[model samples]
Target: MKILIVSQFYYPENFVIYKIAETLQKFGHDVHVLTGRPNYGYGYILPEYKKIKEEEINGVRVHRVDLPARKRGRLSIIFNYLGFWYNSRKWVRKTKLKFDVVYSFQLSPVTILSAGNLYKKKHHVKHICHCVDLWPESVLVTNAVRKKSLTYKILYSWSKKLYRACDEILIGSPSYKEYFATTLQIMDKNIVFVPQPSLVENSRKIKTQNLGEGFNILYCGNIGTIQMIEMIPEAMKLVKNSLVKFHIIGMGPMSKKLVNKITELKLEDKVIYHGPLPSPKAAPYFKGANALFVSLKNEGIVGKTIPNKLVMSMAFTKPILAMLEGDGKRILTESKGGIFARQDVKFLARAIEKIAATPTSELKKLGELNQIYYAKHFSLETITRKIEKHLR
Candidate 1:
């Protein structure tokens, strides 16, 4: 298949979308990526990438488009979206390379919006939009996108049109597929549940470790608005006496704020902040921890979205300690590999202690089960093949 993947973010970084494209290439498929220049969580793109034209990396062709540095404000995000859409539209037109299908990863829906028109009219390329998260519903909660405003309503309508135009839609979880297909009136055949692809091999080959006498908990991923890291300080305070240490590894807008709160709660000793390590290096942290932490905000819309970290944690055979409600809770409880609590500090502390007290042998078995379940459902090998079967 000749596939063109349009994502707001990509490789040389640890995004799930990049891995998906890479996996497809591994399967003897021709893959081309259209992505923004690398931007660290601080909202700034590297100067070197600004002028980087089309290039090939590791058998995959990449077309880099110039986008403004990552800025946090609502206007900043709007401009970034518009900027990428304009530049990418120009690049696609100028290149004149024919693609069988254009697959877009949401976060920047404008990619589908911009390219869909051109593909439909000129090339008649099939369009596939992967809904990583239900936007406006997801972004609107954060201050990044204005909610309940004229601009938001217009964008929401625009998003609906993009969804309708696409030949197919992919979402990470069944709950999401149901919500969009049933509630939003999207066609059933057009929607599919293809969970986030795994980026790591089996953890059995990786060196294992037991980090300390106390239970060490690790949370690896973006510490941003949807994650609700603000609840962690109180949760840590409640379990300070346990042999529990919290390690947050990943960068985001709330990293500094989380550090400050750890200090204020006097959990500086209990909580360790190690911002953004390379994805390969992250496996050891997951191995080192006695348990992994996955969470989402309490909002109904956010609950439907699956955090990629949960699947990756399961890949490492690490049991998850999730602080979420709804589908996230069901994913863990039904799997029986982890425990969950709402945002209540006392309840979370209790769940933490429950996992902490379990025998190491039992935890290992739980981890293995988690990994097997994740592999069966969310593995890149399985999901990418499913996607390949569908691509035009």
Candidate 2:
């Protein structure tokens, strides 16, 4: 199949969609990516490719579109979306390429809306809308869109239209699937529960056991508002005098806020912020950690969103300490690799202690179970096969 992926973010940007596109390419599908230049991440852009123009990064063909360089405010974000849409439309019209399927990842609804609309109109192709988060929910949490504003209603209506127009809708969590089906009155056949895959390519490199001296609790990936990263400070306070060391290795909109909180709490000695490490270097942090932490915003709506970090931690066989209590907790409980605290500092402290006191042998077994479960259920190979079956 000739597949065209239109995403707001991609490789060297520390996102999973890049790896997913590449993996699909490996499976004998011709994959083409239409994306904005690497924009929102702590990673540095490639020196040569810094100024955006279409170029092949790997085997997959990529059409790099231009967007507003700065991503600071509402006006800037809107401009960025417009820029991507404008450039992407020009590229698509100029090239006049026909694809078997058009798949787009959503961050700003505008880019996908433009491409999906173009593909539907020009080539009469089937569109697959892969939604990582519901728009208004994400925008509200990020402060990008106000709850009851005109902009919010417009984006919400557009999101619903995009959902309805697509041949299939891929949501990251089953909770999202249910919400779309029941709340939005979308048909069951239109929604597919397709969780994101971890960027763990070399599973063989992941050490099954921890050799580190202390219990290192690692929280990786974005530390944004949706993550509720401030919980880390309180959770650290609960386990301060213990043998556990908290390591946070990521940056986000809340990075400065988290750093300030850590300093305020005098947790600089206990909590080490390593900033953002490359994808390859991040493995050791997970491998050495006795447990990994997963958090979601303390909201009823946020309970349904599953951050991709959890699956990566599971892939490394690291026991998880989930701080949210919805679908995330459900997955953790079903896996039996760890326990959920549901945003309670005391309970999180106790959960860490329980993990700390578990015998190394039993911990090792649980770790293996975690890896086995991830391989069976969440690996790209498994996921793509499911997608293929659905496509058929």
10 residues in a row with least lDDT, candidate 1: 108-117
1-392 per-residue lDDT for model 2 (tens digits) = 98898887787676788878887888888889998777664333345557757677668888887776545566776776777778888777877777888887765454465776677668888878777767656677777768789988887777677677778877787777666766566774577788888888556776543535677778888888778777777777877446777889888889999999999989886778989877777787787777788888667455666667888888888677778667777777778887677566677777767777777787777777788889888998888766655544
TM-score of each: 0.90, 0.90
> For model 2, what is the C-alpha lDDT against the true structure?
0.75
Worst 10 residues of 2 by lDDT: 40-49
- In the order shown, the candidates' Cα RMSDs to the true structure are 2.5, 2.7
| Each candidate structure's count of clashing pairs | 3, 0
How well does candidate 1 score on lDDT at residue 15?
A: 75
Q: Which pairs of residues collide in model 2?
A: none
Which residue runs of candidate 2 sit more than 4 Å off their true CA positions? 42-46, 50-52, 108-110, 206-212
Candidate 1: give its CA RMSD in angstroms.
2.5
Pairing residues by index, what is the TM-score of model 2? 0.90
- Please provide, for model 1 over 1-392, each residue's C-alpha lDDT reduced to its tens digit, 9 standing for 90 to 100: 88988887787655777777878999988999988788735478776676887788778999888877668666787677777888888777887688888888775454445664566557877888777777546657565557768878877777666677777888767677665655456764468877776677577777655566677989888888778877787777887455778888887788888988988988877888877887777778888898899988776566666777787888888778888676667777767888777677788888877887889999888888888788788887888888887785
